[model samples]
Target: MITKGRVTATLDGDFVVFMIGFRLNKIWAIHKWLPVFLAMPKMLKELNSNKDLGYLHHEIWFGRTLILVQYWRSKEKLLAYAKNKDAQHLPAWKAFNQSIGSEGSVGIWHETYQATRGTYENIYVNMPSFGLGKAGKLQFVGKGQNNAQQRFEKNE
Candidate 1:
């Protein structure tokens, strides 16, 4: 359901923010890019099916360049998932390297951030729980939590 008022999100401890995506460089090379594109859903399905994998939640946007923002319980869990041989990620990664291999047909990249209390803050107004809000606890923005600086101070 949609939350009608100002709200904020808080996590108990440290968390991980993983941003991963791909850019379709050569649109005509569907053969080279489509496999790369199709691989993500399989991995996402695997992660979603198993909560213990450390995958909390994810938001995806599609276009010429696709962006996926993923929240993880911890950095160790994220790295472990990436390297897990029995998981979908490892096989898909191997396929990407064998097929695409920096040919410029498809450009894939990722950025990982480690966040802790006092290091990150967020506010949502008249919107449904999203992003960090979905990954963490949602609380109505209180008297001292009306602004970014206040949120930071409160979190600190």
Candidate 2:
């Protein structure tokens, strides 16, 4: 449901923001890009099914350049999940390297960020819980959290 008023979110401690995506360099090369595109859902399902993986939540946008923003409980957990041999990510990564490496038919990239309390602030107006709000604590904007500056100043 849509939240009618301004809302904010806060995580208890440090968090990780992982942005991962692919660009269809050759849109017609379905053979190459399709597999890459298909791999993500499997990984997502794996992560979601196992909370111990430290996967928090994610938001995705699709197009020629797909974008996925993921939240994680910690950087160590994120790296562990990426490198785990038992996970779907490693296999999918290997397949991508073998099938599409340097050919440019599909391009993939990711960036990771470590966030601590007092380092981030967010607000959502007239929207349902989303992004950090979905991954962390969601609440109505309070007296000291009404503005970005104020939110940033919060002691947490």
Query: What C-alpha lDDT values do all the predictions have?
Result: 0.93, 0.94
Stretches off by above 4 angstroms in model 1 are: none
| Residue-level lDDT tens digits of model 2 in 113-142 | 999877889999999889999999888888
- Write candidate 1's Cα lDDT for 1-156 as tens digits: 899999999988899999999999999999999999999999999999999999999999999999999999999999999999999998988999988897789999999999988999998989888999999999999999988999999988
Q: How accurate is candidate 1 locally (lDDT)?
A: 0.93
RMSD of 2: 0.8
Which residue pairs collide, candidate 1? Answer: none
- Model 2, position 114: C-alpha lDDT score: 97
Q: Candidate 2 overall Cα lDDT vs. reference?
A: 0.94
TM-score of each: 0.97, 0.98
